[model samples]
Target chain A: MRRLISMLCLVGVVLFGACALGKVEISGLFMKQAGYQESDIRAMTEEFLKMRPDIDVKLSFVAYEELHDKIVVAAASGAGTYDVILLDCIWPAEFAEAGWLLDVTERLSEEDRADIFPEVLSAVTYRGRLYGMPWLNDWEYFFYNKKMLEAVGAKPPTYWTEVIDIARKLKAQNIVEYPIIDAWGQGEAVVIQWLQYVYAMGGTLFDEAGNPTMNEGKPLEALEFMVQHMDEGLFNPACIESFYEEVRRVFSAGQAAFGLNWTYMYNLANDPAESQIAGDAVIAVIPGFPDGRRSATCNGGMGLSILTSSQHPDEAWDYIQYLASKEVQKKYSQNALPIWKSLYDDPELIAQQPELIKVAKEQIHYIFDRPQVPWYSQLSLILSEELQAALTKAKTPKQAMDDAVSRTKEVMERYAQ
Target chain B: MHSKVPPTPSGMYPRGGLLRRRETAFAWALILPSFVFIGVIIFYPMGLSLRLSLFQVDLTRRGAGTPFVGLANYIDILKSGYFWSSVGRTAYFTVVSIAIEMVLGLFIALLLNEKFRGRSILRSLLLLPWALPITVDAIMWKWIFNANYGAFNALLQQLGLIEKYQPWLTRPWSAMHCVIAADVWKVTPLVALLLLAGLQTIPRELYEAAEVDGAGWFRSLWKITIPLLGPTMTVVLVLRTLDAFRVFDIVYVMTQGGPANATKVISFLTYQEAFKFLHFSRGAALSYLITLIVAVLALLYTRAMKRQIEY
Candidate 1:
C-alpha cells in the first residue's frame, strides 16, 4: 500500500509536467521541393512565437503520402491530434463536409481574400465557406532539353503531334534513347498527369449531374494518345512505373528530351549540383491538342486549415495568417510558388523566380481541377486502374474507358444510396 | 476389479459440493483479467465490426445517419469483381510464397543441422534478414527492382543474361512475382529458425540407427527426417499461410497493387475500402470474410496434423 501510494504520487507529478509543457501542436508534410521541410517550418514557428509570446506552437512533419491518412484517422476520431492541418486542395471538400474543419470565411478581410488567386482560393472553399488558407500553389510543368531540340533544329512543341514528330527526329539522330518521359505510374500521380491532356482535349471527367463520362469523346482520345506514344517508343517504357521523382531523375540525367512533372522539378533541373543537364533544361507549357485549344495544368496546391477539435483554434488561425502573409510568402518564394496574386508581378519576387513570372502566368490561365466529391479517392483509384490496363495493353483504350465509366457509376450509385 | 477412488485433499471438505465451488471460483478469479483483456482487445472490436458490417456508415456525411442494411455489404462484396480479383491475387501470393519459403527454409534448416566449421556464426548471421523490420526490407527491395538503375537489371546485363533492362514492377505478372520474392526473402529466415528448433529436438540415435541399416542420406531424409518434421512443417504452413494471406506491407511499398491491381491482396483492398474510401461497413465485411478464410485454413491444418501425429 505504501509503494502504491508512492507510485500514484509519481504518476501525478509526471501528469503535471505534461500539462505544464503543453502547446498547440500542428502537422504538415515535409517535402523540400514544396518548401514545407521541418527546418523551414520550425524557423517559421520560431518567428511566429516572437510575435505572440503567449502562444506556444509545436509542429509535426510527416511525408506527403502519410499526412492525409494521419489527418483523416485523427479527425475522424475527434481526437484533437492536431490543431492545424496542411491539406491537399482535393481533400478540403471531403474534410469540410465531415465537419472536421473550422470555417474561416468571415475571418478573412475583403482585401486579404481578394489578394489570393481566385482559382486557388476557391479550391479550399467548400460551398462558399472557406476552410483553409491557400499556401503553396503547386502545379504541373513541361520541361525539355533545349540543347536536344536545338541540335535537331527544332523548337519546343506547341502541340501533341509536334512533340511526337520531334521525338521521332530526336530518336533517328540518336540524340537521346527516349524523347519523352512522364510520371505515369499506376497511382494518383499518373491520373493527375493524364488529366492535363484530357482537359486540353476539352473533356470533362464527369457530367454536371456528377456521373462519369470519360468513355467517349475527347477523354478517350487523350488516353489513346498516351498509349500510342508508349507503343511508338516516344514515351520511355520505364514510365510505366515511374513517379515524379523518378521522372525528375530521368530528365536530370539527360536520358530524355522531354519530361512532364510538377513545378518542383524546375528548380532541381536547373541546379548544377542536382542535374547533369542543368544548363540545357528549360520549362514550357504542357502541349495542347491539334485542335488549337489551350494546354491545361492540374490544380495542385495545398492549404493550412484549423481542425474543429483544436483546443486553441484562435492561436492556430493566427499562425496561419502569419504564414500566409505576403511578407513571409515572399521570403519563401525561392522554395515554393506562392499563391498571392501581387507576388506574380512584384519585381523582386519575379527577379527571384524568373520562370514563375514568365511561364506560370500562362500556366495559371488553363487550370483544371479534379472532380470534387467525397468519393474522390475511390474515383481516382478506379480511373487509374483502367488507365493502367490500357497502358499495359490488357484492354484497348475504349474498353478501359468504358470499364472505368461503369465502375465509377457503380461507386456513385452506392454512395448515393 | 473396482478401482479405488482417491480421497479429497481435505476430508472435512466435501468433494462434490461447496469446496469444488470454491476451487472453481478461485480459478475464475485467476483467469478473469485475461478474459477481460481479450474481450477488450480482440473480441469486442470483432463484435463491433460484425455489427457495423450490417450498416451503411459513411462518416464523411455524418448527417446521414448510418442506416441498417442487413447483409447488403456482404452481398455487394460478393458480387464485386474488384474484391474477387483481390481474393484471387491473395491466394496466389499465399500459395506461391509458402511453397517457396517452405522448400528454402527446409533446405537451410537441414544444412544447419549438420556440424560444419563456423556453424554457430552461420546460425546467428542467418537471422539478419528476419531481424530487419519489414518496411526497411521492402524499401531495399524496391530500389533493387527499380527499372533504370536497379541492381537487378544491372547484374543481369553484366552477366549477359538479358539483352536489356526489364521494368519488373510495371507488368502485372512480374510485379506480383517481385512482391512475392520480397515477402519470401524477408520471411524465409523465420521459417528456417522455427524448423531449426524442431530439428534440434529430433534424437540423434534415430539417424545413427538408420545409418547402421545402410540408409543413404537422401533415403534417411525422405524416410525419417520428413516423417518426424510433419507436425512442425504443418505449423509453419498454417502460420505462413495466414501471414501471406494478410500481406500488406511489402505489396504496399513495392507496387501498391499496381500495374493494374495485380498485386492488390485482400488486406490492401480492405484498407482501401475502409480508410481511403471511408466505406467502413464494406471494409468490415471484407475483413470478417478474410478472418473466416484464415480460420478455416488454420482449422484444417491443425486437424490434419493431429491425425498424422496419431498415426
Candidate 2:
C-alpha cells in the first residue's frame, strides 16, 4: 500500500507539472525539400517555442511528392496527429472542398490582408475563403549560363523568338550540344513546365465556365514549340525523362546554356560546391511569346494550414502566424522569399540576395497558377500522361490535347455528381 | 468372445479414447494462437473492406456521406479502360518476370547442386539479392538505368552496342521491360534455393541406375531430374505467379507508372484509386478483385499439392 501510494504520487507530480507549465503541444507536417530546409524549420520552431513558452511544437517532414497523400491519410483518419500541415497552392480547392482545413477567413484583419501580396495570398484562398496563411513564396525563373551567352556575344532573351535565335547560334557555334533543357518527365513537373508556356503565350487552360480548351488554343501551340525544339536538337533529348534536379545538373555542368527551375535552383546553381560553373549561372525572367505576355511563370508557393481535427487550433494558428511573422521570415529568407508585400522593398532582403531579389520581383508579377479545382489532382495526372505522350512523339500535340480534353471531361462529369 | 461389442463411433478401443481425445484438444490448444492471429489480423480487416466496397466512401465528399452503392464500384472498375489496360500490363509483367526467374533459378540450382570448389561461398552469396530490401533493389536498378549517367549506357557504348545513350525508361515498351528485369533480379535467388532443396531430396541411386542403363546427362536431366522436380516446380510456379501478379513496390520506386503509363500495373492503379484520389470504396473494390484472383490461384495450388509424387 505504501509503495502504491509513492507510485501514484510520482504520477501526480508529472501530471501537475505538465498542467502547471501550461503546455499545449502541437505537431506539424512539412515537406523536406524545395522550400525551407529541415534545419531552418527546426531552428525556427525552436525560436517560436522560445517566444511562446506555453506552446510546444513537434515537426515532421516528407518529400514533396509524398506530401499530398500523407496529408490526406492523416486528415481522413480523423486523428489529430498533426495540428499543422504544409499545403501546396493547387491543393487549397481540394482541401477546402473536403473541409479538412479550418475556415480561417475571419482570422485575418483588413490590414493583414492588404499587407500580404494578393498573388501570394491566392496560395491559401479558395473561392474567396482563406483556408490558411501563405508562407513559402516561390515561382519558376529562367536560368542561363552567362559564359555561354558571352561566348556567343548575346544578351538575355526578352522573348521566345530571341531565345530560339540565341539557342540556334550557340548550337551552330558548338558551344553547347543542347542549348536548352527542361523538366518534362512523366509527372506533375511536366504539367507545370507546360503551363508556364501556356501562360506565357497569354492563354488560359479553361473557358469562363471552366471547360477544357487545350485543343485549339495556345496550349497546343506551346506543346508544338516544345516538340519542334526537341526535334531540332535545340532542347536536350534527355529532358524527356528529366525532373527539376536533372535540369539543374545538366545546366550546372555547362551542358546547356538555358534551363528552367524553381527558386531553390538559383542558390544551388551559384554555390561553388554544388555547381561546376558556379559563377557563370544567372537568373532572369522567363521568356514569353512575341505576340503574347511579356513574361509568365508558375506559382510554386505553399501555405501553412491548421487541420480541422486539431484539438488546440488557437495554439496551432499562433504557431503558424509566428512562423510567417515578418521577423522569422526575414531571418530565414535564404531558401524561400517572404510572402508579405512590404518585405519586397526591404533594403536588408534586397542586399542579402541582390540578383535573386531583382529577378524575383520581375518574375512575381508574371506568376500564374495551375487549375484550382477539387478534381485538380486527377486533372494534373491526366495532363502529365498526355503531355508525356506528346513529348515522346507517340502522339501529336493536337491529338494528345484532344484526348486530354475528352478524358478530363469524363473525370469532371464523374465528380459533378 | 462374449465381451465383444459393437465398435464405438471413433472406432477406438475404449481404454485409449480419452487419452486420444485429450491429445486432440492439446493439438488445437497449440494452434489456437495462430487461429486467433489470422482471425484478428486477416479476417477482421477483410470483412471491413468488403463492407467498405459496397458503399461510396469518398472522403473528398465529406458532407455528402457514404451511401450504399452495392456492386456499382466493381462495375465501374470493370468498365474502365484504364483498369483493363492495367490488368494487361500486370499480366505481361507477371508472365515475363516469372518465366525469366524460373529459368534462371533452375539453372543456378543445378549449378549449385554440383560439388565444386568454393561452392558453399557461392551459395551464400547467391542469397544476397533475395535478402536485400525491395526498395533498395529497385533504387539501385533505377540508378543503373538512368539516362544521363547510367552504367548501362556506359557499358553498351564501350561495347559498341549503340552509337548513343538510350533512354531505357523514357520509352514506354522499354520501361516495362526494365521494371520486369528489376523484379526478376530480386526474386530469382529464393526460387533457386527452393529448387536446390528439391534437388537435394532426390536419391543418388536413381542417377546410378540411369547411368547403368546408358542414359546420357541430357537424357537423365530430361527424364530423371525434371520428373522428380515436378512438385517443387509447381510450388515455385504458384508462389512466383501470385507474388508477381501483385507487384507494387519495385514498380513504384523505379518508374512511378510513367513514360505514358507504360509500366502502370494493376496494384499501382489500385493505389492511385484509393490513396491518391481518396476514393476508399473504389480502392476496396479493386483490392477485392485481386483477392478473388489470388484465392483462385491458391485453390489450384492446394489441389496440385494433394497429388504430390512420393518415392
Residue-level lDDT of model 1, residues A294-391, one tens digit each, is 69898888788889988888888888999888888887776567788887889999899887668888888888888888778888888889999999
**What overall lDDT goes with each candidate model?**
0.85, 0.89
lDDT of candidate 1 over B1-311, digit per residue (tens): 01233465768656567866676788789999999999999999999999999998886767788999999999988998778889999999999999999999999999999999999999999999999999899989989998877999999999999887788988899999999889999899999999988888889999999999999999998998888888899899988988889999998788877888889899989988787777788889999999999999999999998898998
Off by over 4 Å in 2: A1-24, A52-55, B1-37, B304-311
Cα lDDT over the full model 1: 0.85
> What is candidate 2's DockQ?
0.57
Share of true Cα-Cα contacts across chains kept by each model: 0.66, 0.61
Give residue A149's error in model 2 in angstroms: 2.0
lDDT of 2 by residue, B26-98 (tens): 8789999999999999999999999999999986777778999999999999999999999899999998999
What is candidate 2's lDDT per residue for A47-125, written digit by digit as tens? 9888898888889998777789889889988799899999999998888888899989999889988998877789999
Angstrom error of the Cα, residue B147, model 1: value is: 0.7
Model 1, chain B only, scores a TM-score of 0.92
Q: Against the true two-chain complex, what DockQ does each candidate achieve?
A: 0.66, 0.57
Indicate the DockQ of the complex predicted as candidate 1: 0.66
